[model samples]
Target: MATFQIEGGHQLKGEITPQGAKNEALQILCAVLLTDEEVHISNVPDIRDVNKLIEILGNLGVKIQKLGKGNYSFKSDELNLEYLESQQFKDEGSSLRGSIMIVGPLLGRFGKGYIPRPGGDKIGRRRLDTHFGGFIKLGADFRYNKEERFYGVEAPKGLKGADMLLEEASVTGTANIIMAAVLAKGKTTIYNAACEPYIQQLCKMMVAMGANINGIGSNLLHIEGVDKLSGCDHSVLPDMIEIGSWIGLAAMTKSELTIKNVSWNDLGIIPETFRKLGITVEKRKDDIYIPAHTNGYEVASFIDGSIMNISDAPWPGFTPDLLSIMLVVATQARGSVLIHQKMFESRLFFVDKLIDMGAKIILCDPHRATVIGHDFQSQLKATTMTSPDIRAGISLLIAALSAKGTSTIHNIEQIDRGYENIDTRLRAIGAKITRFD
Candidate 1:
């Protein structure tokens, strides 16, 4: 158990580089299992979830070499198939949600895959039907053992591609089916596929490794089955969610901060969403420069004179992941806005913690919250709290950074699972935070 003690009301300055995308790293690292050659990866974020997946790979006899900082080469030339069924593998695999993604590559290359029920933040009902359903549609036998809480997929004869439509634009589901269909015997057409930058990067990496995939950035994809795949080098894009968080943090704390190498073009609707909250975001040579808020930012009104509402949707829409940080930022804005988190039912529960710190928020329902900004007129009082999830944990930290006194946040492991060296990075930018176990 670890905790963070932070003193608020200090303005942070200097340039902070966002780490490589955590979500992208999850998919990219798991894709390493699809090939037997040495797949070199760079700009990998050193986080708990990623490192745990790497450990699971090493446990399965995947030859891994740590080349340097944020660099690694993975060779899955030999594998321990029995390790997937071990109690140890089950325990480790169940500890992280990313572990479930490994099943696709394993099933595609080795004709069998097994996984325990995945574990992650308790935000909402993230079903695995999308994943298993795709595998089943692609000529694999799927079974679930309720007593053991495990899922198994096998293609004794070999996987054969088929035309199927995903029920929803599930990101992991799309990636899983893509990985499986790459080695199948026929053509595969996937409709309503998730076209997020993370998925796009994975497809590009697959192309580099000799997978035949068409429609790289759209909902429809056509894949031709290949005999085998080779390894290639892949460098992940910068973390866009973190960039948005830093933008909100700077505006709330009235700080001057520059987020370096943000991959501006790939941040679909993120910067504009913050600008809707009245933050000045300047794109300077692939970096985002957020100026100090001396005059204070205001929440914009709709054309119909109604209070602005910020909601989450699929790709090309506001990502549900950053709604927590946006809600935190709205607490200090000059006007009121409604924060509607449409994707996850339980994610907005963290608003109660912000309300404890003197922010005016109305929890309309599990999916929506209304925030009335204090506009720096009232300072948030320090309080003790526990983090429920990754985004909420960072949101609370941002709130504490702009509060009146010292605040303590427990269960910081949730934050570390996503963000790499968060406290160390904040300290470099003049934030007063200390970690203790």
Candidate 2:
């Protein structure tokens, strides 16, 4: 276990280039299995989750060669289609939610895929019903063992494409089915598919590898099955979650920081959402330069001319993962605003720490909270805290960094799972922080 110690009340300054998308990187890595030739990937984030996926891929008979900084090439040559049983695969695969994607590719290519129920952040009910729904759609049969808490699927008859509509736009479910459909017998029409930047990246990479996919940016996707796919070069997009994290960190600490090479096209309504909080943003082409200062918190009214709370739904809306960070930023704003987390019930429970810091907030229920911004001018005192979830853990770090005295953040492994050398990056930007094991 590691801990981060921070001396609060210092402005974080300087410029940081964003890392590759974590969500996208995992899908891209799994897609490498679809091809036997070498697939070159650049700008991959060297985070725990991505590294764990690589280890799992290696055990799957994928040869991985790290070419240089943020660059790697994978070759799934002589992929052992036989049943895989490795302790490393299970250990690393169990740590992240993204590992569920291996099921589709393995079943499609190798005829059988086995994995345990995954363990990530304990935010809420992250069910695999949608994923299983996708597997069943692709002609795979599922079996589970309650004693081992493991799941396995077999698609020996081979996958035949079918028209499928996801009840919800699950990112992993879309990725899973898309990977499975690449080798299916017929055309697959996936309506209500998740078209987030990550899913789009996977689709683009699949196309480069000769997968015929129509409707790249729309929720309706058409995939024409191909005999085989060959590897191609692809780069992961800059992580939107990291961009949002930087935005919240800058606003909370009142620091002048520039996030470079941010994919501005994918940032639909993201800038507007932050602007509603009174954070001034200077957009120069693709780069977003955030100047120091918060202009008081403002509650966003709906376009329907009604009082509406900013919350998380699916993609094209505010992400559920970032609502925790946004709630922490609201602690220093000027007015009151409601934070609704429609996807998860337990996501907003982290406000109790900010509540202890003299901020005015009321937890309405499991899925909603009313944050009464105190315009926290007086400093927040330091405390010993343990991180609970990935987004909430980083939010706690921001709150601790902006507080009055020194704060010790324990259980930082959760934060490190997503952030790339986060303490080192923050230190480069004038944050007084250090990590200890």
Candidate 3:
């Protein structure tokens, strides 16, 4: 495996562009399976998970062409349906959670879809029931092959849309059902759907491809089944999670950094959440300029004068993905705050590694933690660590960059799965991180 050796205590300066959204890319890339026409996509992040999904598409006979860096054209004119039944296909599809999305488009166009148990971060129990339940509700037969450990959805008479009240507002599940319903025979209404920017972008892309979708940014979605869909060009929004990470890094290391082309309208409550931690973020057109937090920052209390609590919720609320970064920034702030990671149970386990670096953190339970900041008076001492997941990996990298001395982080493949060329990009802004095999 590869590792990152970072020399901490350096102040980063200059501008950095966020990578294209990884979550959106997963959905958009799989949506290509819904049409046989050519779809040109730009601003694609060259990351491990996305590339793996592209490879799976190629293996399934989708004709792919490289247009340039962060650009590609995909045409699913001919698909190898027989490959879906093979062991090689099962092994490939099982490697990433995004693979589950392929089922919807395949079931929509070809009347059948199959997937192995998808793999992803071991942060919590990510159930596939939300995805399969939607399929079963939409006039499809759902079955799990116990021997092969695979899930399959088949509609021999073709899919017919029906009203569905999602058990949870699961992002991937919402996308999967929408894709399946687009080509279904009747009207489909989805209540309690996930309305995050990722889902919004997917809806826009499908609309561009001629799918009749209403309510792009709300909990209720209505899709009218169409005869077929065409293809269109799309560019993903900047990675909001990466932008949040940069904000945390600048505050923790007291650096001056500008994040470029961040879709401000789509950022939701990310900037305000960071500001609650006392970081100064200036909006320069479409970019965010974070000044050096040298004088130190403090957590802001509520109007009632109660202790501040930063927690994750659905969209328009704090994102669960950024709670890790916020937790790291709180380590160097001037007050205490409680981080409640309600969506995932075990994401807070990485705090143990941060405590080894001299951070004052109390792991109250599996879902919550209380962090007592030292206000830069006590610098974290660098040590060897391992990355837990994509978000936690970047959070630990930010902590390592702000600490004193050198730190080695192993299993950075987790980091590369989301952030594109992270070390090289951070190096351009004056960070001292090197990658080695």
TM-score of each model, paired residue for residue:
0.99, 0.96, 0.99
lDDT of 2 by residue, 1-437 (tens): 89999999998888987899888999999999887899999999989888988887887788999999889999998776443556656666778788899887776676678888898888889888888888888888999888767888888888888999999899998999899888888999999998888999999999999999999888999999888998899999998888998998899898989999998998777888888888877798888999988444455567886644788877788888788888888888877778899998888887888777666778989998988776766556677788998899999999998988999989999998888999989999999999999
User: What's each prediction's clash count?
Assistant: 0, 1, 0
Scored by lDDT, model 3 comes in at 0.95
Per-candidate Cα lDDT values, in order, are: 0.94, 0.85, 0.95
Candidate 1 residue pairs in clash (backbone atoms < 3 Å): none
Clashes of 2: 1
Model 1: ten consecutive residues of lowest lDDT: 312-321
Residue 55, model 1: lDDT of 98
Q: Give the TM-score of candidate 3.
A: 0.99
Tens digit of per-residue lDDT, candidate 3, span 165-259: 99999999999999999999999999999999999999999999999999989999999999899999999989999999999999998999999
Residue pairs with clashing backbones, model 3: none
- Model 1 agreement with the true structure over 105-220: per-residue lDDT tens digits: 99999999999999999999999998999999999999999999999999989899899989999998899999999999999999999999999999999999999999999999
TM-score quality measure for candidate 1 = 0.99
Would you give me the overall lDDT of model 1? Answer: 0.94
